[model samples]
Target chain A: MGEFELIRRYFLPLAGQGKSRSLILGPGDDCAIQRIPAGRDLVFSVDTLVEGVHFPKYYRPDYLGWRALAAAASDLAAMGADPECFTLALTLPAADEQWLAGFAEGLRAASDAFGLALAGGDTTSGPLTLTLQVHGTVDEGTAIRRTGARPGDLVAVSGTLGDAGAALEYLAEPAPTPDMAAMLDRYHRPRPRLELGRSVRGFASAAIDVSDGLLADLGHILQASGVGASLDSARLPVSPSLARLKGDASVAHALRSGDDYELCLTFPEDRWGAMPESVKRQLSVIGVIQAEAGLYLDGTDCSAGGTPSGFDHFRGKG
Target chain B: MGEFELIRRYFLPLAGQGKSRSLILGPGDDCAIQRIPAGRDLVFSVDTLVEGVHFPKYYRPDYLGWRALAAAASDLAAMGADPECFTLALTLPAADEQWLAGFAEGLRAASDAFGLALAGGDTTSGPLTLTLQVHGTVDEGTAIRRTGARPGDLVAVSGTLGDAGAALEYLAEPAPTPDMAAMLDRYHRPRPRLELGRSVRGFASAAIDVSDGLLADLGHILQASGVGASLDSARLPVSPSLARLKGDASVAHALRSGDDYELCLTFPEDRWGAMPESVKRQLSVIGVIQAEAGLYLDGTDCSAGGTPSGFDHFRGKG
Candidate 1:
């Protein structure tokens, strides 16, 4: 099928039939139109996931679609912006009907779950790559940022970390334990912490979604806010599957592995008591922001060493 | 260099040093933030140009950069929305410093000319692909659409057409006359008529940009407006360079060539007198809208014909 035929059959229907308040115009025009509420600012983010880099080419098409949107949505979560709508610019090797159907289903699932409209997008042919741009809205000057973490603020993380990296390990292993299935779920279908992010808007001094490992992404907050952090290795949140692993392996996974999609944030210690109870229960205090200028692990300095780097896609052998 | 370093060095510098009144926050965060003026709505469009599909793999990085942004900006022009910020998601096989430098220079030029901030973007490793999402703003409910054309309204177009296609033909010839250079420039860097588009806000009833040939794109307006059109073949504006082409080649080029990046619109016949002289001089009243629903080229019916299709990347013998 041609581009329009595939989009008409697969994507037009996926744009969602339900009416939306913020969407003034949907697909079918040169541009899609949306109205932001008065006094609100819009958060815009663009992320692309490429096969053989971001994920394996053989990954499930449905999960891939979900993951692409969820990954983009996580940026909005970090900014504490409510889900609005998103555009998908998809390039594929061919228009496989089965694959398109699976992708559409997962896209729909994420759209419905997040209450975001499909908005508009483009479809073309190339090696499989998905570029998603999400538009979200937050009250003026109320959105959380990565530049507000001050010294003495408490550092915390929502949900468990290192599970997605474990899922990658499971994919390579000939036989993975039944318990690893949960880690796989965490990897394939990460729930963007939208509600929790929104709840923490005024309280969270600084926030960032952990895509590039805990320390690396949190390091962004520290760098932006001009502060350091002392992470208590024992307090770092990890799933039961990861906890079962050996000491260093689990610690490395928690601190150095990426693709967790969990939110690593900092806020005033006093505000913890004011956060909604449900949100409070979902978070774990892992560290404290410090005036010193580097990351410390278990009271030891480990900031300037190792491949302390996350996956740098472009550095891969081309 | 890795993706982030490349972004930090090249893309970050091109984000522009101008202080934008609407862009409240710039890159470095998960999402860039912009405030839309009250009583206005946001217009969004995304375009993906994959190497070997949209353009040759060896095309100049500078032209490719300009073309990518201009093509995306054209969509916003069709909506008669004012220029705003944009996000780019680029995938590349490897980072060639020379190519990156050229691309960044062209990007900076376009970003300056359009007054668009490089809000945020992502870079990754893959076969070279560039996806750009442009956001523009129009007064709420005043933005022109493709569904408002009516019978008897004059069919019009802004700037010239067919030079881009002529440029393609020139590219294949290996060596061409100096005249073809202008055509190639049109193909590589056709201006998005944002000023004309904004001027037509209250005047044009229906509008679209000619990316998929003049007739094909105007046909889109007809389809949406549930109307037909009649073109005075002789009146279709051909670029001065294209007008020099011999016989039917020039006519076909004017009508069937795509990537013109010019506006195709319909407006009231009487209201033509009220248009600013500058805008009127720039627009060509090539045809008239009709109630019967199909495109007639100078009284000849060529709707159901041969490879009379535009560039659809997905349908390449698949």
Candidate 2:
């Protein structure tokens, strides 16, 4: 099929699945038009997933589609923004009808889940890669920023971490236990914490998605806010599946491995008490913001020496 | 350098150069925040350029940067929107400092020229590819769409065309005559007709950017508007440098070439008389929209047989 035919057959249906109220024009035009509701700020982010680097060459198209959109949408979740619209600029080695169908199905599922309308994009011929740019909206001055953390703020994380990183071990395994299956699902279909992000908008002083591992991502908040943090190693949230792995190694994964997609937020200590019980139940207070200038783990400075920096595409493992 | 360091050193500077008023936060955040002006609609488009596909394998990085952005931005211009911000998702096999510096320089120059702010994006490891998603603003209900053309509308195009196509033959010729150099420049740096597009906003019934050849793009407008068009072959505008090429083939290029980055518009016949001289000087009225349901070139229906359908990534020669 030609490019237009491919889009019409597979991707065009995805555009109709979850039409955002903001979206005026969807596809088949020079540009997509969207109206930003009054008093809302637009939040934008782009992420690229490359074959063999971000995912295996033969990764399932459906899972790859879900993972790519979920990962990009996590940035908007970090900002406490309402999901609005997204664009996918996909470059593939060839146009495979079956693969396109699977990918589009997965994308449609995510678009519906995230409430992001498919606005516009491009499809090209090249080495397999997917670049997703997501746009969302947040009420004015309510966007949670990395620079908002202050001393005495409690640092909390939503959901457990390390499951996706732990799942990497069983990816090619044909059969797995229930725990392993859950971890694999976590890796393949990580959900963005959109509702939690929206709920914590005015309450959370700072927020970030834990994409580059806990230590690296939280370090960003600290560095940007000009504050520091001290984490109780024992309090770090870990999934039951990940806890069954080699204990220290699984903890290490939680701290150093990326793609968790959970929100790490900091807010005044008093706000924790004020949060509704339903909201508080999903969070674990793992650390506290401090006046000090470095990350501390169990009273030891881990900011420089022996630091496990997050995945850096240029300098670290792909 | 790591991906963050590379972005900070090169891309960060580009963000500082053209800070759009709507931009609240740019790079260094998980997502950039922008305030959309009240009562305006956001216009979006994305384009991807890949190595060995969109351009030569060892094309100049600086020129690639400029061309990629200009190509994407042209869609916004076609919508008659004011350029606001863009996110670039760039993947490269390696982090070469010199190449990055040159690319950033070119991107910065275009950012200033087009009044676009660098927002947030991702850098990854892969075969070199650039995907730019641009966002612009247009007055509510005023965006020019492909469905708006009426039967009696005058079909117009901005600037002379085919210089870029004619220049392709001499791409590898290092030393060239002044005319060849000019054509080469046109290929490398085709300007988006933003001013002309904006000036014709309320008057122009429909508009499209001529990126995939004039006929192919105009066909989009015709198909969407449920209208036909008749072109005067002799009235098609050709650049002086392109006209100097072999006559018949040059005219073919003018009709079938892509990458012109010029605006093709349709407006009522009487609206053409009201256009200011400044805007009129940049346009050529080459055709008229007709009630008949097919494309006609000098009264000859050329919509189907022997038609040049322009570039398609999957079925065409990319």
Candidate 3:
């Protein structure tokens, strides 16, 4: 079969099932069709992950597929949109059936988990790359943005941070404990906090997905909101596995290392006590938004006359 | 500034403008928030063009940018959806300011031409590739599909075909001719027949975008519709430029050569004369659908006994 036939056989099935009423048409047409709900806004984001750049070249195809979809979907969650559909633009050097099977299985798992259906996309032969454009919807004027943080908002995050970075460290090195392996799995399969994001619709003043380390991604929020933040280093969320590896430096690693894919958000302190127990268990109050314009660690400015650094696509040692 | 900064400066301005009633929250957020029109279906498609794979490695960056958007937008047009918004996922080996400037210019031109607003996307370090995901809208139960063709329907196509293939030949060995340059331009900047598609909404029984050559792309319509077709080679729309390039073999090029991005559709013979004159100017009756279940060339069955070929991503030679 040709590439088109292969796509029709493998990918089209993924598009047709569990689709929302908004999806008027699925795959098999020139394009898939859907309707945006009235009184809601569509949230869209695209992310590309290339082999050896975004993930290790030796990574399994299944995890690669899961991670790629999660990374893109995380952005939608950050915007407090209900995951609707996604289109995957996948490129590979050659069509290896085993690899394709694994990839499709992983993608299907992610789709089912996230309540999203594959809409339509192109499959081509090239270096291994997966680009996913995810579509979502949120009620009008209710979607969270990066530029809404106020000076007195409480800085918070869902789930542990620095685990993905720690996982990467373990992946790059030799054998590690089972705990470390679990941390690595967290890195590979980040569960986007879709439900929590939706639940905190009116609570969060600002929200961002942690792809680049907290300092850098949150810096975007600070920049857009015209405010700064003071992240208490002692309160930073570092997994026990990471703490075991780096001892006291774990806080620094958690602060600077990225790819956690957790939601970093700010809410008024008044709502903190009313937060759900589940959310409270999952999240930690790490800091507070400040009137000044720059990230800080325990009141001292981290960007004090120095360039802010995290992940740089052109220069990062990924 | 690096690639990320360059993108932030140049491309960010293109987002969050125009009739943004559907946009709840726009650029500068973690993700773009759009409202899917409540009762209408959303149509989606994605296409990726890699340097040296889809276009000539040395092709103009601006044209590359335009063609990439055109290729994806054409899919939406074929689905009879109103052009809306698009997200671009661009990967480059390095940041070249001149290349980026030209590319951004081309993107802006296409966005203006198509009335599609730019959405959020990702930029990364990798082999030069551009993946575009275009989203459009169509009313419920009104969007055309590929599986709607019936037996005895009249097969038609919009605009001339094979010019892009002829253009490829001219680019390979510069047999410089004004007609050849025009053909090359057609390959580089295909105008998607969105208006014609929307106009022929109730008329077309089945439709597809002609990216993988006429016969192969149309084969999709036949398979999905459970019908066959007999395409008259003499009736195949060939430009004056292509007629000069291939002489007697022009028919072969029109049948097998890809990258045309035209529309191949089927309509009931009874509705033929009622088609709009503007659409008639762009469309031509090429063949008739058959009771049998395979594509044909004139009267002979072409599906079973012919060598299947179009654009093969891994094997094609520029």
State which candidate has the highest DockQ: 2
Q: Pick the candidate with the highest lDDT.
A: 2
Between prediction 1 and prediction 2, the one with superior lDDT is 2
Residues B81-106 of candidate 2: C-alpha lDDT, one tens digit per residue:
99998899999999999999999988
Tens digit of per-residue lDDT, candidate 1, span B172-222: 667777678888888888799888899999999999999988877887888
TM-score against truth, every candidate: 0.95, 0.96, 0.94
Per-residue alpha-carbon lDDT of candidate 3 for residues A1-318, written as tens digits (9 for 90 to 100): 568767866677678546654565666677876677678777788899988899988688888878888988899889888888888889988888888888888888898888889887888889988899888888787888898999999999887887887777678657767878877888878888888888788878889998888877888889889898888877887778777766776676677677888999999887767777777787889999989887877766776533455223213211
Candidate 2 structure, TM-score to reference: 0.96
Q: Is the docking of candidate 1 incorrect, acceptable, medium or high quality?
A: high
Higher-TM-score candidate of 2 and 3: 2
lDDT ranking of the models: 2, 1, 3
* Root-mean-square deviation of every model: 4.0, 3.4, 3.6
Q: Model 1, residue A60: what's the lDDT?
A: 94
lDDT, model 1: 0.85
> Which is the leading candidate under TM-score?
2
Chain A only: TM-score per candidate: 0.93, 0.95, 0.93
**How accurate locally, in lDDT, is each candidate?**
0.85, 0.87, 0.80
**Candidate 2: which docking quality band?**
high
Tens digit per residue, CA lDDT, model 2, A1-318: 778777788888778634687888998999998888999888889999999999988999999999999999999999999999899899999998889989998898999899887888889999999999898998888888999999999999999988888788899889888889988999999999999999998889999999978988998899899999999878889888788764655667777767889999998978877888898888999989999888887787778732454222213221
- Chain B TM, per prediction: 0.93, 0.95, 0.93
